[model samples]
Target: MTTMTAPAQRFREFRMPDVGEGLTEAEILKWYVAVGDTVTDGQVICEVETAKAAVELPIPYDGVVSEIRFGEGTTVDVGTPIIVVDAGGDGAAGSADSGGSAGSAGVAASEPPAVQTPAPEAPPAEPKRQAVLVGYGVAPSATTRRPRKQAAPDVPAPDVPTADVPTAAVPAQAAELNGHDRAAAVDRPLAKPPVRKLAKELGIDLATVVPTGPNGVVTREDIRAAAAPPAALPPVTAAPEPLAATAGARETRIPIKGVRKATAQAMVTSAFTAPHVTEFVTFDITRTMKLVQELKEDRAFTGVRVGPLLLVAKALLVALKRHPEANAAWDEAAQEIVHKSYVNLGIAAATPRGLIVPNIKDAHDKTLPELAAALGELVATARDGKTSPAAMQGGTVTITNVGVFGVDTGTPILNPGESAILAFGAIKLQPWVHKGKVKPRQVTTLALSFDHRLVDGELGSRVLADVAAILEQPKRLLTWG
Candidate 1:
């Protein structure tokens, strides 16, 4: 008798993808799904905060969730699988391609009335990963944390229709479709999360207001308009109501935890342990802009991104050569200052949650193209929330580009363990004396902060002045480098 037994169901756990900028772990700020929730591939399942951004993580495999390892407010190190989904019987869920994106187009045939069926004999296949993580371990465990009691075993109810609604209204929909519960609330009017938060803060009821959007979703402008209900009259009243008055009275406190907590502890330890000194330099960066433009058009940098920051990074590396002390770090315990020949350039990026500094390893030796690519990748990785823990570490020096936000200059605090950190300010077109004549030229400011105990003002000023000099005269960079 050849009665074939069905093969046991097999599953693969998708570890958290390196969101960018050498992050070891992320805090699960919001969950978009619950246990037993059926999700589709590429569907956003949760919101996580990395050093640079709050990114919505997508599910790579289409299936019902079986477990969730970390809860909201937990900053887990990299390689931890936070969520588990039943990705059908045979569809493989694993590492994504090198770009750090999970691109598993789950088997299409597995959808519909037919369930996913796993092949009895299969080989383990690892995904091609993209970005790197920092501080976190290199290898991730294959097994998931543990199984959870997702809401419940969804009752396999037969397809039935509600009274008055047509058969097509149900849509053969999966039990755990997203937004199903919120559809009623969203149907009347809609807005982005930030917009909704704004409306809530402003004491405006979204439903009462007339929405001016394609799908009636309220935009930022719409919220602003609603805040000013009348063209002439101010939205807020002179007399305070009890709700509005008491809203602020109740002190809402957020526990110092996760990124905020960790950042605080690190900063305290850094500030108290290191004797700090900060200095600033204002300069005309017109030459740097012109050079950046030329580099962008050059064939050597065909695919590379050319920006003012690249020049600053290069100038810093060159300065490090002349002043190796600034490139080295103070090891108080060892009573020795280790001077490194290689430079790992760190860039501090402002994320939605807070600040993160991811570094470029051996950046001192990279060519213009290589530096451009590294800078581009570093910023994008931090912005994308995928930086690795290892990449974030071993930084000899750091550069924080506050200039992008329109600030002229700032005295940046040194990254812990490093001797020096530089801040690149915004470059703006301003009237300047060039060749003894007032001319409209691009201008910017730079700030350098160092450990005074290790880096004296003379050394710090020299390092900064050298960087400023190269930027002031673009040709000097060629001669200096």
Candidate 2:
């Protein structure tokens, strides 16, 4: 008699790998894929947080994702499997056609695979080695999903902004969970949570329906266009008073603490104490933008973002190399200029907490892609209010990205402790006298400010001109480097 036999199967589980930072646990900040989703080996599946910063975690196996062992914001430890995959198994998950759900690592009827744990440090027994997401090492462990939490009986849950809640949050079973209301966090016309935050900062309302991205996601372009729409009324003859008049009747209060408070005091001291002189130099950076497009396609820079700002940064570091005096700090007590040989390039990022100029340490030593990755992590940390005090110090030069708001250009104040600050304005298609002919080109205005006590017009002008020249000829960065 012929006996029925089962099909061969293999299961893969991705554990939290050794980040090499001697970290005990990490917070799962984001999950890119869900269970039952198809993923290849090395695709970024989740982001975890160590003590230093958060990092993306990659999948170790190539197969149909069967189980996502952890949810967002869950803290996991090393050697714990965060995901389970049916590697080398058929495409379908647990289907009758996909080998009947029993893989090599499949949980046996006697001893099931243990879920991820931070305690009881058992030696990790894992499957074959695979890559971790953020250039980390190997990991192996099974996964178990934890039960949902019931918000304690008394404490009230803060009102979640309507703009913040996505379709993903509205589960099919929200109705069964105690009459919880899904009223939009924002009453504006229609916008995402982030978009609503942007509008609020710029003092805009969503009722002005102009969409930039898919599903009405407003882009920076949309915001700028809204502020200064074309085909509008004629220019006003009279200009408003500087800084505008303060409101006498209405009262507003904001707490003086945290990063905002620190930034405020420093700006006040720097503006009053430092004798600042600012200059402007516009450039046509069509070539630099083209280079950025090419770099984005390169595999080495795949996970690392390469943007226009990165090139601008490179230009600054290069200029500083040529002229070291530009990378000095004004010394009041010492009565001497403190020149720094190393450039800790600081990028002033405006977060909800206000302006914080966190810098990249030894920025001049790193390659372009490495700089881009550092910048990405720095900005993300600043926005989340996780940036520490140490990262904000020891900066020799600063770059404030006013162009992000589509601002043409502005004479920005000097950041405390820095002698020179460069301002990169908006990039737009504008009529330019190119090759002695009027043609549309991606153009922008660049502004440079320096401490007049140290830098004369010749030095400041040279620094600004050098930056503009590189943007005009991006290939110069390679030759010059």
Candidate 3:
């Protein structure tokens, strides 16, 4: 019998698009669809964790999922084909058509070749348009690949064994080791720059630390675990107590990934690169405290968090308006000072993931109530680990309310690319001279740290003084604004 067969089916492949600004890779956190499931264009098919934040990737086309190339928890590089789908027709329809055509053609035409139907090819894959992700734009074209650097010519290998060779001779290795004297731990353990810094800060040797991350990379948690003190020292009279059960079991290794890793790198860069100059001022903020209490009782602030931090943030914004130089960054490469006209006020939130500073866009334009609402939302999102990386960038100034932790004050480090960070200390009812009378007043300490290159002592002091003045007189916002 002669048979006519349905045409070969065409499948569309969806490659992993860059989810963040120039992020090369992302770990597939979860997949929302399975093989055989139908998906529409602009529907989120999977969630990926990039170095900056967790992001969801939407599928580009209407189709039945034919294959999943990667599993959850797998790290995928950008431009790699991640999924395949049959866009033209269902498999069952194709199969049924093929069978019917084959049987009919075989019976009808024995002499002539059976007529074959050509399956319509799926249209050229279009770049999936994604929703606005923070810090990432909609990929112009999803199908395009990043241009790769040209390969260097191969050189003949040295005749000696290089395994034991100390990497200290290499300048890059020296820089990574944190100094010229230390040798690179290339042969021992692999860790990211932030993890290496954490290890260095904790005085832990990565060579001795156990790696628990993918591909045997030492994580921050591993460094912390290694730095953890033994449960108890062995008694002098006793044989070293067989390793205590609590030694390793008691410690928790939380991998330094995502937000925490990014924060660490930024902090290190800010601390070392900028010449920081901190100035402190202890002030009486009774009026601001009173205003906070009044706001909480107001119907407008119902269900919203009203606290001293709100006033502190507002005060900082006002101060920035008065001393614009305080809201600037030193551009070393450009050798120019970038004085921001508008303030993207950043609020430092200590979230479960780590400390993240998500800024309120254009805090200078936001009213007190709007600023309060933005602050509350920013904190809530941060605590939920849902703050997008976009919310964390473009900060002109930052306020860290360490006062919530009951600390008096701290020399807060400047956030990278920003000139100043204001540290708000705890407000306590202390005896203070109010109108030349010693009485119990709401007092707090403020510490302002700035990049000395862009902000001089006079300018930093003026900004701190202005914030203190605003806090001292809550009515100044109405007049200054």
Q: TM-scores of all models? A: 0.57, 0.50, 0.66
What lDDT tens digits, residue by residue, belong to model 1 across residues 1-481?
Answer: 2222222245546566667554555677888888888888678888776654466777656678887777887766566567766766542323222232232322233342223433323423433443443222233334222232231124222322222222222322322234555344324455555567778999888887776754355665577676774753442332335545575555333444444555676678888888888888888888788888888889988887888888899999988888887777888889998878889989888754457777898898898789999898888877766655556678778888888888888877677888888988888888999999999988888989899888898998999999999999978877887
> Residue 432 of model 2: what lDDT?
90
Tens-place lDDT per residue, model 3, 260-310, is 787898889999999999999998999998898899998878778888898
1 or 3, which is superior by TM-score?
3
Clashes of each: 27, 6, 1
Cα miss at 180, model 3 (Å)?
43
lDDT comparing candidate 1 with the true structure: 0.68
Regions of model 3 farther than 4 Å from truth = 1-9, 88-254, 299-303
lDDT of 2 by residue, 1-481 (tens): 2222332246766667655334445668789998789898779887765444446767756788877877986766565667777776343333434454454224433233331222334423333545553343454334322221222224222333332333223322222223233443233344435456667778876668476554345654466567664654222212233214555635333434434565777789889988889999877899999999999998878787688999999998898888888788878898998888899988998876567888999999989889889989988888886666568778878999999998999988888788888999999998998999999989999999899887888999999999999999988898887
User: Among these predicted structures, which one has the highest TM-score?
Assistant: 3
For model 3 the local lDDT of residue 304 reads 82
Consecutive 10-residue window with the lowest summed lDDT within model 3 = 144-153
Rank by TM-score, highest first: 3, 1, 2
State each model's CA lDDT, in order: 0.68, 0.70, 0.73
**Model 1, total clashes:** 27
